[model samples]
Target: LENTEFNLLSMMYDVANILAFKAEEKGLELSCFIDPYIDPFVIGDPLRIRQVLINLTNNSLKFTEKGEVSIRGTLKEDLGNRFSLWFSVRDTGIGIPEEKLDKIFESFSQADTSTTRRFGGTGLRLSISRTLVEMMGGSLSVSSVEGKWSEFKFFIYLEKQASDSVSRKDIDIDLSTKNILIVDDNKTNRDILRQQLLKWKCKVVEAESGKAALAKMREAVDSMSPFNLAIVDLQMPAMDGLDFGRLVKSDDDLKSTILVLLSSVTNKGEIDTSKNIGSSRYLSKPLKQSDLYNCLMAMFYRESKSEKILETVSEPTGIIDGVKILLTEDNLINQKVAVKILEKSHHKVACANNGEEAVKMLEADHYDLVLMDCQMPVMDGYEATKLIRSKPEISAIPIIALTASALKGDREKCIEAGMDDYLTKPLKREELNMMLSKWANKKHKQ
Candidate 1:
């Protein structure tokens, strides 16, 4: 039941089922040993904790093909009035190299390119898990032996609760009238950023390319108003955050805007360059909500009394009006669900059940955007996209790949095949809208 105590066992069971399905598909075994006595209630976010467990279990399944993946959770200890809970997920998969074990927890850091080639992910799960665990006053750690297996363990301290009543409304932030700019080449990243910012009631603007971001700033200045902060991506075509920031700082009028550079690059030299441009903060890509929130809070608190009051941006629940979209999917259920979501956002949508249909439809009519399902009958997304790109007339049309696969090299493959962006399956409405809005804005500028 939704209102029942947030039991770790139930969450583990869910993870076990997911792993079991994955194992079954790959011909492996998945099991769990969860202690029934482990505190089923904690004054914390259960959904987030579940995400951590699922991520670990999913990782286990990804690496293991013939061996078993086992999960165990128990009461580590109770320290007087407070209690510590520990959970371990172990796998008889390819063990991580000892040298690379620590790096795996870093955002976008995988053991090797081959890992990405074989398994699809942004390599963001573990990093997100670490952040989530820490936010809940917990610690997550990992151990592995090369050519053997691996184990991931985490401990969280929780106060015993008498009732299963908790409300996230208490954590809601008030962000009204704050102007925030999100800059990322990836539409999904922009979407996630926009949705999270909007939740705080902030006014959100998006730029897909760094060149466009500079143009946006100029437009804002021309209108006699500028954004409060710019969340710029470090990697983009035409221009990057370092160069963009330098340009911003060089302009006397735009110098006042706070610059927050985002990147997946962990090289210290690159970070130093960003800092030299007078950026207020630097955030790594696959942004975390808590870290972003903290940075915003710190920025607001440090601002001068004469500065404008900041508003929190909230997630937009409905779709923007008048946008036309093409849905390229072979699966009827997927098409229905995706179209229903797009319709809720007020977008006029056209459907193509396969890549050939999508191509044929594109030839006859112009759709504002295309959501191409990667794997399809008749013509797969990659081939279809390449075909679209080869055409001189329709080459500029933005096409985003909707994929269920999260293996490494997937995003790169999509991009190489001519997709402008991508979203992993079980699509979130906010991410979809963000991608649409971002490309739509680009189309408007063109």
Candidate 2:
């Protein structure tokens, strides 16, 4: 068995070799360039770093067919006390478009159906890689072209010391002394939030409505133990995120407490209003653990841990409130089927009969998620998604491939086009509902 503590270059080379073999199968050249002066002994979990490198290299090999795939590592000395190392995997395959570049690190994202069909993979490598990098005090990034090539780059800080000298004991991160109030009408949403907060060893309180939240605030003050932070949901029954934030900010006693607005709407105006109401931050629902942890760290650590903390949380806005969705498909029947599935959940849905329409719609409106079809009249889902992601305004919208094509690489292609998620053709209600529910609920919690 491999040791978990050491950062082994040999293992990294082995992974590169495996990917190189895969690349050669498609007549692609693969190579690696490692800086000789770089420190070989760095503090980190070797297994996790290896996992990140393997995933990135594998992705490069999977996408490149006719050209070379290169992996390189270089150390930067200008990082002050921190030793910053940059690692990149370059591929001469079809590069990613500029707009879709941001979503590449998001989970389940793929470029398009064509890429997915040609290469079979879940498109989760980058997201997983990003998570691993962050845990090791680093960041992962990418640069790409539409048809030329793509490059995945990451930077990590390595403490110049032996692993044994560093304390490996788990740190007790407690939020129990500080009160946390959760405002969400949905019981399921409240439960999930509570569970996650509890994992952080927080003392959690729940509010089912805006009125209840206010009452709880009053009760907490009266009881001589007030909340340190309030997590409020938008688009609720009585008071929405904006109104609730306004109320909390206006109150002298509660104004100082951090307010986090959670929503499923990508309405920019609403987000601005929340900012004006003294909300420290906004979180989109379908809340990821990393995002939540980062927000909390920012709040508590404030000045000292700002950069490290905020990196984990997204901008906290641009979430879809009424279930902002993009529907892509050429067949009218399939579009209707998809719409019916979403509408049943009372989610607002948008439709594109062809890839061109999908692109146009994406340009016109901000969607929380997109459902794309493989085949279409004017433009196909692959081309449309690729184009949509190439645009800055709509690039981050989660694009789910809705196609009849079930080939091996089709999923990978969808991810390669910067699509966030995927669903097979002859859509099933249960599957769609599960996805919508999971993501929508996450938005609600944020």
Candidate 3:
């Protein structure tokens, strides 16, 4: 097995990110949590681990019509240099029958023939996953109730790489002095947030609901200690994040407290609503530590009054609004999805069916950035980049490569082809936002 030292948290984020668009398209919530206490840098076969997770999560999404699919990793046992990690993919989907469960992991076998016809799979994923997990020193297991939910889990021992461990000092923003409030109806969500905040040395207080959070905030205020930040969940029962944010913003005393609203991927449109309600930032779940760190960095660090971090974090389009982007791809479906994601962030997007069209479009108009797909019918992204670089006028614009290939060295190939960066399909909106924020030239935005 390809054993290497990798950031466990980053690997989990990549899995969630790659599947995020799919989960959103299916109208499902995808949540990922890795135990905060565990040192995230570990020695293991990350690729195989990621593959198993993706397979299980994809199956969960395929079968689940409603509710959420959660991927969680807990520190089962701390064994000094090695740790026993319990990983699980849980979904509120149709589960296997008790008798059929034993055969589900058999090659070419499924819960039933109807399941094969309905879900449309070769039914080899679980079998292959079991093989991979066992190769990695773990045995895959499942628990399910036929009509309700299913959970696939395994325990694997990984060597903790303390030399590569992430600490509070690694974060760019200073959170030690910050007092934060986490509001979520789910205790697990709150606990995860609390643990993360505590790890960053932030003082955290949790509330079960928006109303309870308000009470806690009031108590903190009355005691001459007020929370500077509040993280609220969007889908709470009675009072949601938008309503809570509105109430806080309108209050004379609590108006200064920064509000960051967490929403499911499907509720991304509600970002606009959160902004309208005066929330400082909106993050789509499942949240990654890097994304949360970036959000906090934006909140805490601002250059000027005009460039308020709140607006930078909350605006409909992106950090730089009204950017003009040219999308180059041959596939109609990929082109459409990319366009929609770009436009949703308030950027103006133009599509080129092939690389030749992309070159022609660039010649005709100015664009802030170019999203170039590697393979196309008429021409390819590599040739298009070379041609663009040969020109003096439009040569400086950033060209981010989009590829479906996951083979090793693909990124290096893209960079060698003169691409600024690369992303694998399908794309996630949060990732696109981060990329745009990185490559979008300020002068190019309207």
Candidate 4:
């Protein structure tokens, strides 16, 4: 029960989302997806797995200036209790030369010496990622073409968890006969979205670029079956989403078609501008089932709040949303779960593998709060809390105990050792939200 079946889907998407923002900065899109049938949970060091994804995703983004970087996760073998999962990261960027591909995984070596200058990396990230994958009894492999694309994948075995649940995706509007257009330069992105739409019985059409999308729409109009919705990437060659929207709105027949602008980055100004230019709504990537589903709902049926993406999901957003938090947890799975929840709400998280590491991080940087796991090898939370309390400057900072023991006096032990509050293991989002909201409000009052 203490850190077994970690969610690979959650880890992959989380890492992708974090890195997608970086890709977006350079006018590129980053996308991540799972097979949907793949077991959501797998046995592994969640943090290490996340680290592999982070390294690979960031590497792809770093090299890619245009087009997209994508991550895909699939189950190769479902062995009931254990499964073999294959994860891959692909990018439409400058790829490795045939000769250099063999050495990219070697320490201090990259595809080219000039790459080190053009793209900022130590060239050690891929080596470290490969090492981490191998440590989990997996092998990392790569295949790339020069000036085109690169894909890195690993096959890892993991035990399945008994107690796991996947979120349900419910569409409010009927997609049975709807005609949808998906426009993205990336084949992976376009294919994934097209497949999902097809499964829902929607008539799907795809275009690799904005010009092609416009031509498709014009053809559809001539055939008398105009697309009901268009999901256009914000960054595209020839014509961007904004320009496409302006052209679409200029035509009377096409103006009736709903437009949803998709971007890896959630820029308020861009979203507003898209709406002003005739886009029905804006959705941020990496796209999730919930995002796609809700986007469809808004575009077709929900007219009141169609323009704003989840404008009321949580108006009085948790104070932790944008706050800096230090997570002092030893268990990789637990750390992943907690960090995932915190990040979904937009909080910036820094992790400490153990109490000693947490102390070092705390001294080196500032965190608004601490989530301290009680059990650790190098330094336990109790002793770590005492040391942190001993420091005059940070003594006033809040420390919350995260413990697996629900036994009597556990709370008292945490309090006695200087933890300001207690949270049980497998923390619930509601409890965390309330705890953070309470502490954040208290801190604000102070």
lDDT of 1 by residue, 119-154 (tens): 654355677678767766789999998767999999
List TM-score per model, in order.
Answer: 0.39, 0.37, 0.64, 0.64
lDDT for every model?
Answer: 0.71, 0.67, 0.78, 0.76
Off by more than 4 A, model 1: 1-5, 80-82, 114-122, 163-446
lDDT of 2 by residue, 1-446 (tens): 11233333333454454354345446554555445345444444544555567668767777777756777677866454347888888888888878878877877777676767877654555776787677677888898888998888888766544534331222236777778999987665576578668767898999999999999998898898899999888768768878888888889877777898876423435777888888887875444444576688788875664444333122222333478777777778887878887777677887777888777777777666677777777888777865654443454455677767787666556655555457887999888876666444333322
| Poorest stretch of ten by lDDT in candidate 2 | 310-319
RMSD after Cα superposition, model 1: 25.5
The clash number for model 1 is 26
Candidate 4: segments with Cα more than 4 A from true spot: 5-7, 39-44, 65-67, 97-102, 110-114, 117-123, 159-174, 222-224, 301-446
Which residues of candidate 3, in runs, are more than 4 Å off? 162-177, 266-273, 297-446
For 1-446, candidate 3 gives per-residue lDDT tens digits of: 65566667767876687677667666777888887667676777765677678768877888898878899999888888898899999998888899988887887787878887987653556776787788778889999999899999988889876653431123323479898999988766777788788877888999988899999999989998899899999988899888889899998888889999998766888888888988889997878876787777668764464234223222124367788999998898998888888878788999998889998999999887899999988899988876675454555467899999978667655654546678889988888888888557322321
- Model 3 is weakest, by summed lDDT over 10 consecutive residues, at 306-315
lDDT ranking, high to low: 3, 4, 1, 2
